[model samples]
Target chain A: MNSAYPHWKKGPGPMNSISIAFASGKGGTGKTSLAANFAKFLSHEKNVLLSDLDVEEPNVSIFFPENEKPGSSYNSKITIPEVDLNKCTYCGKCAQKCNFNAIAVYQDKISIFQELCKGCGRCSNICEAGAINLIESEVGKVNEYSSESLEITEGILNTGNIHTKSLITDVKKYRHRDINIYDCPPGTTCPMVESVLDADFTVLVTEPTPFGLHDLSLAVEVMEKLNKKFGVIINKSGDNDHIIEDYCKKGNYDILEKIPFDRTIAEKCGRGEFYYDDENYRIKMNNIYNHITGKIK
Target chain B: MKKIAFASGKGGAGKTSLSMSFHKYAKDNSLFADCDVDAADAFLLLEKEIQHKKPFYSGLKYKIDENKCIQCGKCADSCNFNAIKKTDKYYIEEFSCEGCSLCEDICKYNAIESRSNCCGELFISDTVFNTKMIYARLIPGEDNSGKLVHEVKKIAHEQVLSAEKEFLVIDCPPGIGCPLMAAISGINLLVIIIECSQSGFKDAVRLINLSKKMKIPYITVINKSGLNPDIDNNIEKYLADNEIFSAGKIPFDKEFVYLLNRKKLIIDSDILSGNLKNIFSQIKNRIEMEK
Candidate 1:
């Protein structure tokens, strides 16, 4: 009469190890600051890992001390189709079949532009003679570091490369421990999706403005589709705006926490200082950490 | 025709407000395109009524006929997205289906047939200001946002050409992702709305970097400039370093909330009209030079 799957019997625990992802549909909603402060708050009782998933523009490293070096680093490579000239027939079929226009056929040769390629393998699949083959192309790097109270992992996409999602996927591989915090890239796109897809819970950091309400709805839609638990945190709360609150009510979303707009917090962040040390900010972030942990557990 | 896009990497940076005000100030026959399909709200500010709606279908979804199915499991095995689940009865989860048609190609019994899935609806509307606006609404779980933005832009461009309009103001989706990229494609100029906050400045840099790479002429507008004077200074320095212009700074104004709540453009307010008029004139000059 016992169920075959014992793992399913036990619900999510206090999750002394939990990963709270701070993501926004658009950039500059204070995801990193919220992420860093949340990490600092959780570090008080558990080992925290702050992962900066904005591979294109990593800012988590700037907020930490100068002596910190990532504990380890990993490379992410994407397979881009590289045509073998000897095998190519110059028939122009690959170019004709490619939907992304990555392949081009000239008078006597076929050229592959890696930048335009989506790595979709359409051209390779369409090649009649199997002239096109995918080769490993290094797209980005993931760096891991350990701080006094937490571990940090950051992904850096090689500038001018379009394969950000692949790099983000590589970064997720480092989430070996529980209680991880992911700092998602701004925007509702493939890279953001890559960072957030695996999280058990997400914290949508937003300001109280029309634009904030607009993008928060998009992020909320993504969470709902993924069937992941989430709550809203109104950063810069005292702006005297009700757009977010109205949205929360309309959508039946929980408002987990609110952080008032403080210039000191901004100054500290600009100076590369952790603002979580500030008693007031720490208290609010701790409440958020506890709330998320409570729900996930 | 002049096409200008208002984009910001970070959300809540005032792209919509600025775009709406520009649409009002231009007063020259113009088409407003809300290219932020995920959350199209420029219409809300303009109090527009959707006059026409069209469903957007990105690709076709293959449906397997249970009557014709032989338990071969080839269709499930061939799906790269793991969209098909094999059980007593085979089925496809619409959300996971990318519409690659691999399942249809692999089905030996010819049981699978492809059908279009409705991602969202695109709208052509008439605003209270009497201007034509093009926008889209994406279903919560819809895919192909980039495709939707492209569709919206196409309609907006057609409207502009037919009306002999002088401008097309696009309120782009936040972030430099596929949707934002699609919104910026073929635009004459990009106005990046930046807020005076640490993350705001950081995102502005990211968006500007993307604009530079795309070879799109762009300028920065620091919204809510009075919030953090220090952060504003940092953004100015960053813009200077990048050789981008600080088009004009809009101070934090309570009237913005009032205007939005009333579903009216800021330029339409009698008290704020002068200020918005000046701001629009400056933006128009800058955009004209870029053209």
Candidate 2:
């Protein structure tokens, strides 16, 4: 079943029916804006589904604020252990059974730290006293924004929660459209791995700086391990660069597009305006979309 | 020792830049730790040779005994991660595998086993400024980065206590997640960096609320402040309404990347040196006030 990776269809599908995830090992390189704007640009000609997997601080929803009439939205909850107070004897059995240390019995009391709970049901299965029960806990909310032909579904994680991967998995459950773009979290960690591993294509975005170059290599290493087809997108490329360009050249990686650093673009971004509406960014993104589609085919 | 952490809920908001600038201008003898282990770029800024090194081990990984596998599908059926693949044989894909060990419990022939691998390596060295620095690199795809961050902080704290360093500067990871929490926990002072972008404002607000909830003494430092007056003003007003102090603002300058490219500190940059000194003074004063 494709429930775990709803956007990903195994093997090759039609040329334009592939899921592409945008990521950068270094954060704040404009992955969310680029993905959001590109999906908007692509939606003009096709059905586009943009999913935000950066649950810790989902920003895609900002581009599509809550509508007055409201699009469909729901909560994504996971199974966490609940203890029946009368049945609980402070036996430490369920606490010992949890592999994540989500439950610990101390001072004849049960303290459950929900952030650490993995919702694997191991504790309830191992509890012999019938004291532990598996109950649903809301880790994040999945909000959907729909227009004439586009749908943007974003997973906003509950603050101070640790189940980032689970929230990403929940967001990926959105109905598959012809083109799906998943905006992944920064850093080469579990969250990034989960977002890009199953996608048909991954677009690596980076700025022209040392920090971007260093982290881009780490992210590239992860894609190599996952055996995914990926390429690099250079953002804010200007003079005082060549760090990333040299690396990409030497590494034999494809350089998709370079969006130069401009004051107008940055200011527009600060005001929550989409760059794709501009003729310049529109032309560039159109080419980028064509390039990704060409490679997929 | 006074523990001060610089964190930006959104990455690339200049946490490393601000920390490096403060370290350059501060007077007190201090220790630094790069708690953003997953993508630790502060190490590159230090340009220091390792004085000591060791392998870090954390979390368990499931390994399949291919030789003993009976070609049955029990392990594949019970795996929670769907990491088991049956290409030629049932092999575990490490990238997707969470190592839950449910497959090991169901295997009839003991074909599955749990083994721990090296999470990454830790390095101990002195920065070009002569301050001791601790940084770590997480083995890609390894989970429990919060634990790695904790180990990095533990080493820095222990070393600072024995050496009597007056302060510890931590370059925290972006986002309000486990690793970020680990970096800020037990801190005497927390410096949150925020930019003027939409996500930056949103994430910074989340971080500020979490800091207040945890009862941590905190201040905000605006990075790339002058680029967009609208978002910047809104963020300043939001922080003010929340009763949080804005330490200072560092203007948006393309030359800020000079130090990152040259591997030098802000003091070396004519473009940034003047304003950086004033911002560093405010941060220093705040740390002393906390003391």
Candidate 3:
């Protein structure tokens, strides 16, 4: 039965299988819960990898308790420039070349905001004098937890650290095998863009309310700008909230699925579990997986 | 003046609605700022027209001068972000570049130049409730959200001085990331609004840990209460274990959402207003004590 579903593989080519990212401009519409449950649901038939790119607050790993016993973790480091005062020429070339404003030069001293430096190597490369040197600093960690068929790879940003985008990119270094589901961070910021930009298909999880409608529009605009194929999945649909449907009809967007608003489901969410214990949603997920893989072909 | 910000690491944890009620009930000369620039909704609920707007320039970004490029491919090789690309001609992918200037550093031919990019816009407005509010919006696919958050706060402070407000209530974006940090930096108090759900507790803990690290005086007010008795008890136990003082709690209500959709504050219109008003004042007293 697991093999009954077709793998989202490209024919004799170098396509990195199928990667689907779940994103929403607004937070707390159950993006993590949906991603977590759907990842397990798809793993029943597919080699699914759930990567939590919401480094600031990764909740997907909360659902995978079996894989909780001390997984192999690695640190993420960024090589920021450390200036050598002895070899310094106050040429101000390095200061002018830094786009992040991480460097500023005065008549007597040069000031650098270390956290602002992205270690892009420009400061070192542009230094006319041999003053700038790069030093690696551990900023975040990427951990891999596997149990049976499912694997959860989460990017955990160290507090007071501001390298979310780069660490999110680093977390993707673990992507291998069939289908990869990236649980992206909320908002349409650069970090979310980085995670959802190159996917085969994207699932924009939204609820049917005014806030949902507003943020969904922003997410839609981003997906359109990236030229990526995407559809909407209303996570907490209720009878009164038709704002999402009204806009989707006007924009002619494809709605993948609508998980009706259920109190039991939400309570289950609180417990890091899905509400429906039966195969009701498994069949729905199968349809989604089939449609996306079919689109790839 | 005492400044307070409401931040929950998880979204939809009742930041904006709670801020509105707190501002109304706090009854001080309050300046409300929405640092949730990623998805500002306090304005939506305020039902106010934009009083003022200005483009926010984060910093300088570089672009290739297709004319000066020798297609040496050297800048692309030196680039760590893989921003420099080659198709018809070598061009810089705007979003990919972290504005590191390494490309310009490596370009010996002087083909790359830098200029200010409009990363976002800051706005000044007043709520129908007669409270002054300042908010900002980050343009889609733009970088430097943390910088924009700072700009919004700066405007908020300026507004506070000019308007002679005594209290500053900031509505922060979800997450313990840079934006929320910028929103609450050097504030008088940190009033965290925690929802009593399991995910809510998990998300709130991340932010609580952040506040503890920043060494800010803080309190917690649980929202969406009476959802499930078992979950609620667990939340209370966790709050007690952490010794994070609970200010008050608001029972879950559906009418609140319907009213919010219409841009109305529940504190003024709903039957739950009495309970919410009580919670707001209790939270207000805690702020006063902290102040």
Candidate 4:
């Protein structure tokens, strides 16, 4: 075990865990790369539970290939209301109560749009005649991958499925360890919010471009609004890093670390290979880990 | 009129940059709509002067009156989202509240009142390039971004019909989720931007799968090519195997990032402009073929 950090379980087991979520408002900003590498680095001493909450396109597991073997997985389901025609009075109460517009009533006929439903059960609960019955519908699957060093739980959303939040919640409920790292989905919407809501700290990753700065600002606003403690990690940092540095300085946000723009790193990430085998990369990850544990502890 | 939307399942995969460049090249014959409400940046490059704007009220959230005599726990127990909390006074966590109004319906004292939230603002503006644009700004941390994207598209579609525009170019949000689905609806074609990285390809494939499932015909563009030859070859193989058409490949260029930092479009760059021209022409040809 690492002498500096407190010792905990050596694998996926229940403990007083501190979760850190790596998120970005813009896509392709190295959230998964940073999250995966950090989790692997931390797992050398303490038990680390890494979760891929980017249900839409989870790529964290791609970096953890175990001799081309598959992980143990199970389907996750959400409840959507189904109207019973016999009990239905066609009064339009359920339709009116649905904020998502998933249900509609017209001229003694009812329509249910399953895709639009959020599975909030409001329509079923509001149905006075007991016509609306909530039914289980599979949205995605939660897969668990384990090795001697680390444990990973990934949420894979079924194609055309929009229930990203429910599936993310299911993945978060799976397991925990000494330290949890969540690779959040891109964008500052519900899915991103759900991913970061329960994290002890959130690391906002970004590049040093205008789009990166803009989206990073939006993500900063979300973290601030949610009252989450967060810092910034500038990936692909180069000469134009002032674009983000100036903004971070103005906002007094902590610049945890920067991963320089290197072609070798990009190639390694493109091939889904770990680039943390070098001493320089290990020091950077250690700095971030120490910074986060120092603050949260 | 042909309406085409550009989307990348991964963020920062150059969807907005490419769409802006396409709109610039297509010139006055096209209109642009920024449907990525969560992180709308089309206006940054388009240089727009807002002509008309309005607050968009998406849904309602129930607020409990502090003076109401009843501090009943029924509302708290009934909320599936666990948004309701009784700490000195009954209150709702605005972030988690879905605005279902079940609490408002059950409260006999009429303590809860449904308040429509101004989740975002919609704008109809004219860009410096003489192109009319429609965009929206969703308040940070607010829900209903998908609904806002739909509203922006609906208006853009109406304007395209009324003004007799030849094309409606849309910039879609990343990820094959609700917002992307909303942006894809009613669009004649989808331009899937694939960043030439393993993560980018994986995400782009997800978006391609979604387009296929929705029966939306699309063309792919592999951006930031030459970053890795292996990834490039793999992407080519996958596209060839699936018989999917690709618009073209864009080499990895630092100039694109500099141009973006300057709030300039690809058409404004001397180096990247030529490649964008070819891509724009190919996409335009595809859209024209649809007619």
Candidate 5:
């Protein structure tokens, strides 16, 4: 089924096809909106792929119409330790060796709490009687969908699970297109980092409030440490004030774009309006897209 | 010390704004902890200088000594995280590993050695507000964010108690993940900031539900209320329906950016100080009322 795309076997696109990641340390800062619009803007000129790496809450699909389906895809699995009671000696070694306390050994048998399980498989390995085995558990689903404008792929992390980085890594295995725009999860943690780490550039979306400045700095620090090129996009731009610009000056970062706080835009989003439907917002996004492409070129 | 955490399950709702405003209102030697270590941002507003930093180690990585002649696929097969892959030669992706040490424990040839990976760094910095800010950073593709959140909160609590400060205001991370849970653990109070949007309202409801389940007393702060006053009304109605107290509503103000650009808190501005004072007084009354 994966044979339709030959580039999938050749490894991700060439280095010339710059990858831009839209990230924010704080949630609700318009990272997804920026990513969706930026993808729309870039699709006009380049072969773009909008990879929604925010697996925990995949919302990028909401930006598109209901008919849109992610193109070629793959299902990823993680190893879950399973115990076979028939071959069990009930020695309690598996429970004792498990560090996460996922396994509880009673007098006669053992129980495993799947939520707390890191899928380490120590229990199966330590089972002296070969009573335990490793089983593949569905952790996430990766979907690749294409539109007339862009190819979109997203990873949906299974609910009640915490291993987002692994799921993101699995989804990234399918990133074979150029000009990839990764919509990263909010926060400066493992999952967010996993989404933005390999990208050639990152666009930090923040509002011009105290909190926005605060989180933007953290995201900038992460990008700086990773040595990835990044710029700031102040969402709700004209609403807050100049704190973001002052922050840019102090931090030596540039304000790539300022998206004014538009009620129409929010209303459109709430109503599920596409980017092109709002011509003014689309123009703004296009300018930002051009700015990014110009910088990269 | 009153340790109040500003948290919301939904991202971009204005948790940072409330925390920053609270920091401005209670600006006396208090410890401002950016417990949203995954995205610590309070330091940016404070213009703080990092005074001390320490690497946070969460889990271990198992390194195989190839010289030990352990081509046994047992270790590779033992890891559930898919950290290990057999490709002619055995290779382990450090980011994928959960540091379970199962590979080392199962290696019969004693070739695997487990070592801790520095997930990120924790910083104790001096902010422009003259307060000590406690924050941490989690490296991308690393685990144990809950542990890091706990460590930073502990440090903030210790500082607050030692200094006899009035408040330990914290900026919490987004979502209901381990980090958010850790941020909410053992806090004196929680202020959930909710934006007036469908997803924001939904996430705020989830946060309030979680707070009730955890028995954490919380209040609501609706930001960007002017974006759509009707939506704000619905959120207010939801809060009323849920019996959650409303702290105050911050109108979508353009001047907020002016304050931010100047690196000044809104509470410090003459125009917004009166409103901020009213909000702080309400917060104080709410806490006292709860007590």
Candidate 6:
């Protein structure tokens, strides 16, 4: 056992369950890699649950084997209104009341687009003619996996589906009560915001480039707007560390750790091989974990 | 006009860099739209000067007047999103409130009022390449990105038609979600940028599936290739097995990142421009073949 890891036990208090989310406004900034590695590192000493909330493009499962997948899986559904045209007075009132434009009432027929519906149930409630019925429609599925000491939950959205935000909410229901880490979707929009909303702290992973800095600033704006406690981690650090370091310094944001731009690590990650087992990466991951727990304290 | 877009399921897969290069190579013949409104970096590389800006108004938000509210908790019970909460007083959480107006309809006290919300702003700008560019920035924490993307596409379509441009190149947001659907709808061609990695290839396949489902013709270009020979070969095998058409591959080069640090496009650089130009020409040929 690594002596560097602090022993964590579940207890009743304000610090009963600590959850942290890793987010990046820019994709491919190593959010998944860093989150997965951190989960593995923390699991060495404490039970950890790593959840992939990037329903649209959930990749956390890629790092784990499928045969070891747990039996807990269920179809995620949303209540979408379907028109029962038999009793229909083709009043356009329900159509007019729907803000998402998911329904359209025409002269002879009405069309209900399931993808546009946010499952608000307003249409069914407002349908005075009793033509609209709220039905459970499958939007995606949630699966849980257990490997070694780490537990994994994945929210996978079906292609052509638009209810990414709702599916993420369903996935969060599986969060472990002791320690949870969420791998968030890229961008500062609703999906990313929803993933990090309940987290006690957030780790913003970014590269050391102009594009990274620009998007990092936007993510910082989101964290600040949400009044969330967060720290920064530079993934592909090189001579360009100052690009992010300077920004973090100016904003008074804490820099947790910097993973250098090593080709070997990239290639290994490309093959679904994680480097947290490496002595150097283990140390870095431990440092980030300690830093977060320090903040919570 | 033909609308061609550069998109990938994974972020930082070199979508913006390649789309910008294609924009430069297309010269004045094409207009550009950066549909990745969440983090629009194309504007930074375009050396753009804003010509016009307009507010993007979308959806409605309800606010409760505490003085009029009797604390009956009907609105809170009726809200589907759990946006209404009682903490000293009942209030609507703007971020969680989807503006479905259910509370307003259920309120008997007239305490709840609805108003249109300004989610973001769109910009029409002139780029250094002497072509028009369309982009927008969605207000953080707002979920109206698909609507914002639609607005960008509408302005771009009008601009392309009015200017008589032959092609419209759009840089789509990552993921196969609503915003991406809005960007690729009715587009003539989708240039899928596939990064040479396990996660990257998996996400790209999803994007390709979405394109096929939408009946939009697409061609793949492998970026960051040669990072791992095994992974690269596997990607090639997948493309071949699926009979997917690929424009070409771009080797992993640090020069591209170096140039981007300087806020310069690879097309303007001497070392990497040759390979990129060749790949982009193949993309152009694919677009022409569609016509």
Docking class of 6: medium
Model 5 scores a C-alpha lDDT of 0.76
RMSD of each: 5.8, 3.0, 4.7, 4.6, 5.4, 4.8
Better of 3 and 5 by DockQ: 3
lDDT, model 2, position B47: 47
> What are the candidates' individual DockQ scores?
0.22, 0.59, 0.53, 0.56, 0.30, 0.59
Q: What is the interface RMSD of candidate 1, in Å?
A: 6.7
The candidate that wins on DockQ is 6
RMSD from true fold, candidate 5? 5.4
Q: For residues B171-273, could you state the per-residue lDDT of candidate 3 as single tens digits? A: 9998887788888888878888787677788778888888888888888888887777777888889889878788788777777677766667878875878
Residue-by-residue lDDT tens digits, candidate 1, A68-161: 5546566667667888888888899778766556788987777788876655555666678998887777777778787777778888776556
**What's the TM for model 5?**
0.77
In model 2, what are the clashing residue pairs, if there are any?
none
- Residue A56 shift from truth in candidate 3, angstroms: 0.3
How does candidate 1 fare on TM-score?
0.83
- For candidate 2 chain B, the 10 contiguous residues with the lowest summed lDDT are B20-29
- Tell me the interface RMSD of model 5, in angstroms: 4.2
The second chain of candidate 3 has a TM-score of 0.94
TM-scores computed on chain B for all candidates? 0.91, 0.93, 0.94, 0.96, 0.92, 0.98
lDDT of each: 0.75, 0.82, 0.81, 0.87, 0.76, 0.89
iRMS values in order, in angstroms? 6.7, 2.4, 5.5, 5.4, 4.2, 5.9
The lowest-lDDT stretch of 10 consecutive residues in candidate 2 chain A is: A1-10
Cand 4, B chain, TM: 0.96
lDDT-best of 3 and 4: 4
Give per-residue CA lDDT, model 1, range B37-152, as digits (tens): 86676766675587998988775667889999997887777554457887679998765565555566567788998877787899999987888899998776566777889999
Clashing pairs in 3: none
Candidate 4, DockQ to 2 decimals? 0.56
Q: For model 4, how big is the CA root-mean-square deviation?
A: 4.6
DockQ of candidate 3 (2 decimals): 0.53
